[model samples]
Each structure stands twice: as C-alpha cells, then as structure tokens.
Target: MAAFEGAANPSEAIESGYYVHAPGKLLVDNISNRIALRPSSSHLLLGGIGSGKTTQLLVACQQINEIEDIHAIYVDVSRYTDISKITTGVLTAITGLELAKLIKDSQDKNVIESIKLIRNLAHGYTTEYDPYDDFYDDGGQYIAVKGIIPKKTEGYGISLQLVETVSKLAKATFENYGNLVLLFDGLDRLDDAKAFMQVVYSDAKSISSSGIGVVLIGSLTAIYGDYHDTVDKSLDYLCYQPFFDVENDPEAYNFFEEIIQTRSSEDFIEEAAIKALIRFSGGVLRDFITLTQASIEETYLSGEDKVQEQQVLKAVDSIGRNQLLGISDNELKIIKQILKTRIFIPRTDEDLRLLVRRVILEYRYPKLRYAVHPAIKPLIQQILD
Candidate 1:
C-alpha cells in the first residue's frame, strides 16, 4: 500500500529517499535462514534499536512472499498497547486496507464488511467474537480508530492470538498463492520493548505448537535482559537466535564497516566515505548512519551537497554533547567538582581503580571518587573554577 506520509518532494528526492541496509553480507545471507518456522515458534528478527532489523525483516518478508505457494503478511505491532488502536491497526493489516481506504469505506460498505475483515482477524479481547457484532449479525459495522480500547495479548494466550489471526489472514492471502507469511514492523520504537518480545516469543511458541508460520521482528541484546529469569525458567526450550553475534568474531569491525555503506534511495556512496564513516562512529552502525545523515544535511547548509569529513566531525561533537553530556549532566557536574578538589576519575575504569589504590597507599591524600575524560577535562576544570 502506498504510504500516507503525504506528498514527497519528488523533484529533490530523485535520489534522497534512498536508505542503506547495513551489516551487509551477514544479513543478506543468514538472517532469513536462521529459523525453521515450521513446527517452531515463528522466527524472531533480533537486533538492537537502529540495528536495521526492520529493514531486514521487510526484505525477508518480501522475499518469502515471492516464493510460489507461500503467503506473507506484515503487521505493525509497535503501536498496539491499547484496545481501539490495536483493533484498528491490526484490522487494517489483516485486511490490507490502508487507513485512508478503511475510513473511506465507511460510507460505501456501511461499516461492517469494510471493517468485518479487520474485526474478525483481531483477538476480541475476552474470547468474545465481535463484541460489536452482538448488536447485529451482518450489520457491516467498522470501529473508528479514535476511541479504540486496547487489548494486549498476554504470554499465556498472546501466541495463540497473533498466530490465529495471521493464519486466518494467510488463508486469504495465499488462497491462490498457496503459502502465507506475515511481517510485523517498527517494533523497537514501541513503548515496552520487553512486553513486545514476550508477545512475539509467546506467539511464536503458540504457532510452533499449532505448526503455523509467522515472522517476528525485534531487538536481540535487549531481549535477554528483558526476561532473563523467565527465559532460564520457562521459555528456554523455544530456542531463539540473535541476528548478529559480535562475540564469535572479535574482529567485527568489518561488519560495522559494511553497514556504513548500505544503500540509500539511489546513488552508491563512495566506498572510502563508508570506511571513514564506520571509523568515525566507533563501529556502531546506526550511529554511523545518523552521523553521516546529519553531516550530509550540514553539507547542504554549507552550500555543498556532499557529506565531508569535517562536517562529520561537527556532527559527532553535536551528538556527543546531546547524548553524552545531556544524559550525564550530573556526572559531568560531579566530574567538574572533583577537578576543583584536584580529584579526577580515570578516563578508563582501570585508571580510576588505580587512582583509588593510590589513595589507599597515601591515606593523607584525598580519596578520589570519579574521573573526567581528558578531552573534556580542561573545560570542566574551568567551569568549576
């Protein structure tokens, strides 16, 4: 469906709307094949925020649906923390109705059939099938998105709910094609990443139980932290795998470098710039792209249109101030305060420990509590003075 993000500046973006999918070879090869969805919980697409998990999932979904005899669906599960909104988005995904089309159908289909496909596909909150339908059997009633009462699927039944919903949609999607695949997008931005993963794993478990097929996209590093105790206790048998494993390859800078060069709307960015980007970002893919994007925007401001190394440095300084300094204002303040006391926290954790050892050796010397980064030390000292 064409997105409703409104008319784009097509003239300027002949190349602007491009996006680069990163961590190239690994994702291009392993991501889609890692899981056996048949007789298994629907596969989870695991990565961190800005890890390009969504892009990978979408591509995978598109690839799967292209296969003969397979059906595919992509649901946006990130927004379904509520009853009404959940009902609307879920309904739309199931029926393939663009929000605009669903609303426009309000007058033509009366409301029910226009939304019947939507309501029928969602978990009716209380095992109740079509609460609105109680009023009329074939009344053709569609719920407005404005006042949706959200019903989140819980661990015990959430798996059943999403899988059942997808299975029904699959039947219709592949009536002619023979297989069904559903893709849920934009998960990391959801309010509770932990809850979403629980829902996904739970749904996957249920699907595995019933032997249905679905694809879940979400973050990996954050997942273990979310339900560690439960994973050890209840869900270990499900056996999930993350998309990227940095531990196996200590020399993973190449992976970071590859992500930096992923395509945007069109033009292939210079390979050298991509390498420069990976280094500039400390090997974080998302950070690398964000820095490049910001720098590219600045280049436009500087009366040029190409991203440059100097502009990138400017982007880093801004990002460092916003992310590092803004988040650690109190810590920075304390660091500055310690400087006034001739105390410094080591730039590295080890250095801080060594300084503490010195305090121990010379009891008369003031005990040190923290250390400031040498790069910022001068400014901090001046601030305190």
Candidate 2:
C-alpha cells in the first residue's frame, strides 16, 4: 500500500492521515500525567533517528495542553538557532519568543506589552501582527529568530541579561496562563554531545527551577552508555522510545502492513513482497515507508499491478548501495565483527554514528540486539567476503 509518507513532525503525520497511535501515545500520556501531578517535573525523552521523537513531542504538547491551567509552549530549537552552538541565552530567548507568540491575542494589556518586550529583546525587532501573512500557520507558529553571536560588549554579561529577560517573561506567562510547560524538540540535531549536555544540566536546571515543566528530546547517545549515568542524575524521568520487534511480534508486522493498506488496497502488495520489505526495514517506521515507496515506484515502472519478490529485491539493492557510499574502513571492520559474532561494541561515537546513519539497527527484545540493516547486510557481506 502507498499511503504512507515520512513526516518530519507529528503535526504533519496526523495531517497526512497515516499517523498510528502506537505505544508512543501511551508514553506521551504518561509524561503528561506526571507533569499534571507534579507541576515542576522535568523529563528527557530519547529515541534514535527515524524513531519519531518530533512527532511524539507534538503529541505530548497537545496532550499537556488538555490538562487544565497548563499551557504548552513548543520551541523547535533547530528552527530558531544553530542547535550545535546553542547556549543558555539563545535557548531562553527562543523559548520566551514562542511563549509570547502563543499569548499575543490575549485581551490583557500587560501580557501584550510583556510579549512585545520579549520579542524586541530577543529579535532586536518587534513582531508586527499582520492578519494576511503572519496569522494562521505560516509554516511555523513563532517568527524565525536567527542565532546572535554577541559581538563586542556581549558575553557572559549579555547572557545574564537574556536570563533576566526570560525570567521576567516567564513570570508574566505564569501569571497569564497559570502554569507553563516547555517542550524542547530538535536537540538531537545538535552536533556536539558536550554542548547538549551542558545545556541539559546547567541551563535546563536553571530554567526548570522557576516552576516551568520541561520535556526535552535528546539523542540515543545522551540517553545510553556513559552519558546515561550523567543524564540520570540530571533528569526527573528518562523515557526510552524503543523499536518494534518485526521478527517475533505479529502486531508489529500488522502495524506496518496496515500502513501500506491505508495507502493502497491489499491486493496492491503481495504477502511475500510486504514481508520481504519489512524484513529489510528492521522495524524502523521511516525506513519501512521509504523502502515501500521505492518499491511502488519500481512496480509502476515495471508495469506490474502488485509488488512481487523481484521488485522488493531491486528496491533493497538501490537502498543498500546508497547506504554503502561513504562508510569508512573502520566502520566496515565494526560491521564485520557484528556480523560474525553478533556482539556489539559498547557505546562509542563511531558506533553511535552508524546507528544515526541507519547503517546499523538496534532492537530490544528477549535482550538487546544489533544488526546491520537488512537492506545493507547482503551488500556488506559481499564486500567483506
């Protein structure tokens, strides 16, 4: 079935009519319940690439808003600033600006003035409300505010000013909305592990101390291995979004089958064809949809009404070749070891990078397991041989 298209965020996924309420929904609800019970609780939600962290965050935001007296402010850090070099100042400013945009339509004059003050301080310009272009989902809710490098007369002192401005704005927001929840997504796009950690521990702590509930999206490396111990001490909750078990779980297989069925009729994909593609997908939702999309294109080119065994193989070959393009000799060595012994080296940057690239897939079943992506495994085996 051809209905599924990979979405970058949950809003788009829901709008696409392909969004499924998997266990991820329960995860969102649990986080919301925690925040509702303890208004000051903060959490870190972790998932690998293609694991749907952004979509989950959007769902969590919507769920949190449904709780009375709680206002949810979502700030996509990648949109407003360079996530790599994100400091306390940029993070706080971007957040304040989003809060301002959320309440700008209020009747309270003090709230409106405070929002204006936040916009001016953060953007060096006030956001002019235009009903035509500015209102009603012009791509994003907040105005795109670029990252500012404090030129001369800026540094720690400038950072202090940002913190103060954010504090003032937070006070106004709390006064207006009753309670505030910060949903920080897209932190996984940041390149530096150390920079991300610094923000999580130091900057995030300072902000949460002001009674604002926070839920941060983080990379797998930051949630597992050596960073795990460090993150454990810093967060109120560490929630892991795990991959599906395609090999043993019937429902997991059916979940993906339904995705295709939603897009096209059952007869459009043969039983063997869909199973083969899912085997190669390694249970990652994005990878599953992408491979299926390519297969559909190949079937169309071949003048076939339904995808069969041959189309799936060809699609895997194309995907495998693309994955093999830039893999290093050392990475090849690691892949070979995993293939031979079925043992994964402890978490390291190089290994984590492979997982990020989707060259490797990690699963949690009877126990933790790692495997080369099924699409690339045969290719890798042929190369190693």
Candidate 3:
C-alpha cells in the first residue's frame, strides 16, 4: 500500500512517514540554505531521470518558504505547459500566472494588467485587427476585408516583454512577501541538453537579475555534456543528486531499507525480498518503488500473502525485459562494453542517451562509478556468456 504510492508530493511523503533522508549531501537542505542566505541567488539542480529531483525540489521549496521574509514558489513546468514545446516566453508566462495567484487581491492596477496579459499569452489568446475598412465596394457589395489578421510579436520583442513582466512580478512579490524564490521543476524533462540550455540561457539571468532566487531542475546532459561549462557558469550554485551507493556503502544500504520498512511491514514482505528490491533498484528511488510495486503484484497474482525473493526476481526480470525494448543494436554494443569494463566515458551523444535512460547508472559517492542497471545486469551477463 504505502510502498506502492509514489512520493510525488514531498509534504505527503514526509507526513506519511515514507520520506527517508538521502545519505551523504542533503540536496534539499543545501538548496534551501543557499536561498535563505541570499534570496536572489540562482541554483541548478541536475540529476538522472528517476533520481528524485522533483521530490527534492518540492522539499527545498517548502524549507525555503519557512524562512522569514521569503516566499518560495514551486512551479512544475510540465504541468503548466508541454515540456517538448517549452520556451522562454512560456516559462515566464507560467511564472507570472503563479505569482499572480499570490497577489490576486492586490490593488496595483499595473500588476493586475500584467497578470491579464500573461494569462492571455499562456492560454494562446491573440488580438485580431482589420487592416482595411469593411465598407461596401463597387455595386454596393459587402467587403469582408480578407480576414482579420492577428498581430504578430517578434521573438525578440516577446522575450523583452516577458522579461519586463517577470521583473514586475518579482518586484511586486518582494514588496508584499519580502522576497520571492522560484523552484522550477520538470525543465529537466526536455528532449535534449540543447533545449534545456536554450531555456536557461534565455531567461535565467533576467529573472535572477530582478532579485528573485531561482532553483531549476535540469537533466544529466546539462551537467555531463558539452554544455556543462556554460551551465555551470550561468548558475550561482549547482547541486548534483547522484544515485545512492547502496551496493558499496552500508549506511546508504540501511537508508534504503528504512525507506521500505517505513512503507511496508515485514509480515507482508520478507527481508530478503526487500534486499533484492534494493539491490536491483541500482540505488535509483524510482526504480526501487517500481520494483517493489511490481513484486507485490507478482505475489498477489500467485495467491500468496507475502512477497518472497522469487517473486521479487520475477518482477526484476519483467521490468528489465521491458527496459530492453527498443534498444538498438549499436546501443546494446555500447552497453555491453560498459558492463564488461565498469567504466563509462561519455564521449558522444549515444553515451549521453544511455546515461539519461538509466541504462547506465552513475554513482557519485565512494568514488564515481558507472554500471548497467542491476535489473538488466543478469540479462546482459547471459548475453555475454
């Protein structure tokens, strides 16, 4: 039950006793502390997919909101707009919408007008105008003046307008709430590193310049690929949330076990089954939950009351097979090389793709290491043999 629930909401996860502190660096505390010390500073939080970046960002937002004279806003970009088509204007518009909610009752007419403009832009409303008179032509025939043309705003013009609007919102938030810090989640879900960089390059500085603190969730490619230096220099701070080193560190292993024990009782799931789930999860929180949930289903379908090691393995294999689907032959070759050597040098776009897909899991503590996801390891080994 509890184990099957996703920790998408940080508050619920904490209150329900399902939240476990990540070992080593505390990402949530680190980001919140920086914002608390300097409310206008910008931070970039980068991690692999399924690395709990969203949960961490939400938690940081909550902590920052508790600080005196500072208001933290958590914006899930994916929920507000299509991540595949995300742009600077869309991001600024979404920020305006969220900030507008905070100051909806404000008497400032300028802020109110800006909020309306932002809502129109976010909702795809366009202004139409007639270029010619609609009077009758020769022979008293009614003229329709072709069609009503929607006024087009140039890309640069739109960018400048959005920047001005966001600046106004930032100032209004400061005047009313003391300081505004925005935690933007789901930008990391962008299709590629180039797209992510474009979003950040276009507006991160402009927003931060308005004395608004920003925390953006970014993908692994943003930190590991060619844009790494540019991204690093653009942000005031960078926090990389790596997968837990459960296999090599006893403390991390115990932390994950605590995560499971808090969610489910041993009477329903055996200790060995929990260990197998953690081991195959490769220390990724999402996979850990997925494997546990799948294992529970496996047990239930078998008419069993408790989940055993056998059921957990079956679940792992099922998930691994699903993961292997659509993987190209060339990609399989690359994976095989990494699996054999336990060394991954991300030299090309393919390597970055592997990293993003979690086909190759990167562990930071106890020295950086890369390996195939544990659930897929046995299958890879079989192929090697």
Q: Per-residue lDDT of 1-385 in model 2, one digit per residue for the tens?
A: 3365554455766777767766424568788899899777889888778776777788888888999999887778877655665754555666668667766687778667767766666656424454456444565434633333222223221356566656666777777787888989988877677767777886567667667788899887786546667787888998877676687667777777777777667688899998898888888888787888888888999999889979999999998899889999999999999998988865777798888787887777535788788889999989998
Q: Candidate 3: lDDT of 65? A: 84
Q: Is candidate 1 or candidate 3 better by TM-score?
A: 3
- What local distance difference test score does each model get? 0.42, 0.75, 0.79
Candidate 1 residue spans exceeding 4 A from truth: 1-28, 34-41, 78-174, 191-194, 206-211, 220-222, 229-276, 303-307, 325-385
Most accurate candidate by lDDT: 3
Residue 205, candidate 2: alpha-carbon lDDT? 71
Writing each residue's lDDT as its tens digit, candidate 1 over 16-58 gives 4343443335442353453323322255554444444555666
Q: Candidate 1, which ten residues in sequence have the lowest lDDT sum?
A: 357-366
What is the TM-score (0 to 1) of candidate 3?
A: 0.90
Clashes in each model (backbone N, CA, C under 3 Å)? 34, 2, 0
The regions of model 2 sitting more than 4 angstroms off are 7-9, 23-26, 105-113, 125-158, 224-226
Error of 2 at 264 (Å): 2.6
When summed lDDT is taken over every stretch of 10 residues in candidate 3, the lowest stretch is 146-155
lDDT of 3 by residue, 181-235 (tens): 8888888878767767876875677777778888899888787778878887788
Sort by lDDT, best first.
3, 2, 1
